[model samples]
Target: MAERQDLTCDVAVIGAGTAGISAERAARKAGARTLLIDPWFRGTLCANTGCMPSKLLIAAAHAAHAVRHAPVFGVNPGSLAIDGQAVMARVREERDRFVAFTKETFDDLPEGTAVTGRARFEGPGQLVLEDGRRIASRAIVIATGSEAMIPPPFRDLGPRVLTTETLFEIPDLPERLAVIGGGPIGLEMAQAMGRLGVRVTLFDNSTTLAKARCAAVHDALKEAVSRDLTLRLGCETSAEAVDGGIRIDWTGDDPGRAVFSHVLVATGRPPNLKGLDLDRSGLALDDHGTPVFDRQTMQCGDSAVFIAGDADADVPLLHEASTEGAIAGRNAAAFPDVAPSERNTAFTLTFTDPPVASVGASPEDGTICGRSDYGNQGRARTEARAEGVMSVYADADGRLTGADLCCPGAEHLSHLLAWAIESGATAPQILSMPFYHPTLEEGMKAALREICGKTSQPVPESRDFGNLPGG
Candidate 1:
């Protein structure tokens, strides 16, 4: 390591989050010298905000919810108690532990591997740091990730408005929560908070819940979630700071006004592209200022520049980000002779009680559909959790393409279907695999049977494979 203000490297990566770290490691493994830079190297957004902390809150809420519903199963569980302080305390402490693990990655880096500053693109292969240091590299990888957006309406309300980045830091649960936006973040946070005894109203301009494209999934999820929170879907909303809290007014099918202690804006997380001076990079950018790039190679217009993760805004999951990073890093190490990486079957999950999920390709015209309604399902009815739908899609050739699921075990079922689709399995092939008796997975099997009946050939008939709709 030298004390030179101007440093040279084979690859320079910006923002040491999930994508950046993976890219740096991949570049190094490809026999290229790499340097990683960020203003604060304090782990990824998942460890700090998005995934882990939200799950901590959801876990607490689900525990409370289970206790309240114990009487339905004839369990004599006593009155439930939700200690807000203790709940948030455990969340923050456990979150810090996970963050500590991520921070250790930086500690393990060899000398001069990481730089502590934000970077601006000077050209295709050059960067200038905030402290006036210059970095010359053969290739540059942009893995800056993203930030939670605050829309115009919620901007001036100050501390009462919370995004994922600031939600976990709240001292206590809100007296009344106005969750704006019905995307995955909104649904999970609103339902979790409501179940934990907060008065929650989930608002969205569209009637869709969890952004479900399939009408069956949308209806089932909406009906189930309405049990916990007030849903004000398809409404135009406005807000302002009142004397003690925030006042929100809505106009639509039902016009109304209400005051809430706080608002959780879960609209979406747009890519973080500000302050990069990307115009200086001389790469073509879209109307949104995002650089034009190939998703398979993660390259920016055949130049020595690559983008991955939320910076590219293709697939925002951590695993997808890691994949993109590996692709970008390997290609950056061998610029102009880069190879394309194969992508995985896509899936996204929203952790509601009966989770909402979509896996693989979306259904289109001419696609055959198969359905399993969980309302009368054997395992669902036996567990008293029967209240959703699963819609599976297939090609005209009988091969599985995708599925939309809103059911008790949608997350697990989504994984199974994603694997089936990735393997290019037909519905009949998946049905040949054993499905256990009286389990949520049996519900998935039922759906495959429906697909079997619709496809070119049916899955071999099993004698009452648990339960059919009329069985």
Candidate 2:
């Protein structure tokens, strides 16, 4: 609590999350003195609450599901017991390990390089902490990350309502859970809870699940998830604290209500710009109170201020956050001469059974699409995972554009497709690449070959960009 402390550095980064750490490293690598400031010491959202913890929960759910469905493969694994306490213990134990690793990064920083306090903009290149400390820097990077949002109806529901952040800390899984939202977090957690023996009812105002853009993949995923939980898609609902738990009331696509032991609000997580006093920073903020920044360069307007990670994006994924953090940090160190960084093709995956994955651009009107059903796929049949579908899209000129998949091994398929898209591989060129027989990847090849057959466009002898396969 040094009331008269004043510090100066070439770059000042707020929030020691993934983006902030990356920014600090990049700034230092660029030979600029940098200071990282954060009040919380837990870790990045991915390690603590967002990605790793949730995936751990999903892993437990997958195990339970496999036991229940073992009869289909003629292997009776016997009755399954989901020890809720043990599951959560392992989740926290492992989660803390991830958090500890992140904490090490900050702890290893040189003396005076990290500060623990909240800060506000005093003016351009100047910041004042609530502790009466001042910081003057050549440039600044905002990487404050995001937090889960709860609507008015659920905000007052007391401990009965939880967010992805709080859900992991609970002692045990609820006997009955009401999950509100059909987005990735909502759907993934809902199915996991259901598979773990919780009576889960998922409600979303939109009928579309997981933002499935391709209709075939949408239907396939919807069908698969329906078996795992109560899906009340296209339902408008509100909650009230009641006896035993909370009650949900709705009258949209569905006209019914129910009460649950607990409610999870997964509607959204806007950037955590609260209390930063952004108005004093001389930045233009949209109606959402987010700073208008150049997403390509991670620069705010043409100023020395840069914004990265969840705080700067409407769609914040971990990989993109990491990418932006590096870009913003480098530019912040080399201010007034910012340049846009190269970005990879878009890729997303919902970690569910028969997980949904999308890569590159989504299909547009008149885009030629080739599809296949896993119900007839050779490897799928052998694995008894015949409950999904996939599609790969191309333009009339016949270059690979993108893909939508809701099938077994989708995580792998989407990655290969993303690389193909990045490599600028065409349908025929991808087909020409050897696909081992009777594997799930053959399903991808099936869709791609179908695209080649459906069009009379001459096959490209080479679309490898520079990496000619088997050359």
Candidate 3:
């Protein structure tokens, strides 16, 4: 028996996470009859669990590290202690306040709109909820984001074997921890926990952190790792439960095992595409179970049906996901004959200590033209904040391709690089500008000097400035 209920809307958005919410709001503001759906009554990960909470904890860890190291600068601080529980409590409270504010924005949608439930496609223009209700729309968007992937051996993520999803729930600080995977999540958590007095062992199948980043980033991050972390690179793990904690078993030349108080699997994430009954709508899923969609416009199968966020098969981040969702929302309601805006301009920041942030091509994808140090070596030494590297990539003709940073002012530096990459700022364009001396951004100038074939005046190596030397 074909059960059918009539529903209609100008736009239907699924998964009200960052991307979904942005798209929903934009669609509604454009005078479209919009309906948005999500399972989290309180809200999605960015609202409750992902970016917001994780960054708060990372920031707290940074503060704790700075205070503990104050004595080295002749500022003696007696008895520095990290109350992990208190810090986590503050994170939760802040998260609650943010979620409440988000709810207000979502709740104020104009009347004659709104639906809250698990929405799945029933047909080309129809959706069925778990509660047996149905709605039809001119367009449907699947913005459902991603979920953490746990391989079979790690299925039992008990207290000690944790994923990012459960990492923040620990009641006490771990004495020693092993973080598996060296991507953004792993590197960020490894650096954060290591700063908070946890002996962090970072295990990665690959030798480099964020292989997508430029090669120079590995050398810069290796310097930071030299300070607070144990880098167990180029090792694949065979995990097993043990007495005090779990032991990560691995084999390479000089193979060994290490036991830690806890193990965090920051491996990677997969699309949360299950249970949507995608086949019910005659939609095809790729082998990995992500929705197949037009990469440029994010439109899946029929032009009227679209998907965004982690489920879109390429590019996943709270920042990217939301932007993609907004585009999908606009494109879904757009006339089929009209072209969408140029495919999304995106940015990503890895919130590690002396955080590594980048935009555009991975080092492997482009040519590295210039490099400079922020903290220990060059101008940053004079500025008393030597902490990171600024490296840029360009095409053979000197057009901007990508850039990476690991330093004190990386957040601000990333903003400028983002603009450069997005605005098609040629290498010469950036090189032409004279930066203020003794500032962190001088690293950018040094890098530009290298690209422009100008010899960089080397800063003396004798001056430590307390910033560690290169890897």
Root-mean-square deviation per candidate = 1.9, 3.6, 5.0
Q: Write the per-residue lDDT of candidate 1 for residues 101-164, one digit (tens) a residue.
A: 9999998887899999889987766799877889989999999999999899999788999999
> Which candidate should be chosen as best, given lDDT against the real structure?
1
The RMSD (Cα, Å) of candidate 3 is 5.0
Ranking by TM-score: 1, 2, 3
173-269: candidate 2 lDDT, tens digit per residue:
8989999999989999999999999999999889999989898899998989889898997878888899999999976755897889999999988
Candidate 2: pairs in clash: none
TM per candidate comes to 0.97, 0.95, 0.89
Using TM-score as the yardstick, the better of models 2 and 3 is 2
- Predicted model with the maximum TM-score: 1
Pairing residues by index, what is the TM-score of model 1?
Answer: 0.97
Q: Which ten residues in a row have the lowest lDDT in candidate 3?
A: 462-471
Higher-TM-score candidate among 1 and 2?
A: 1
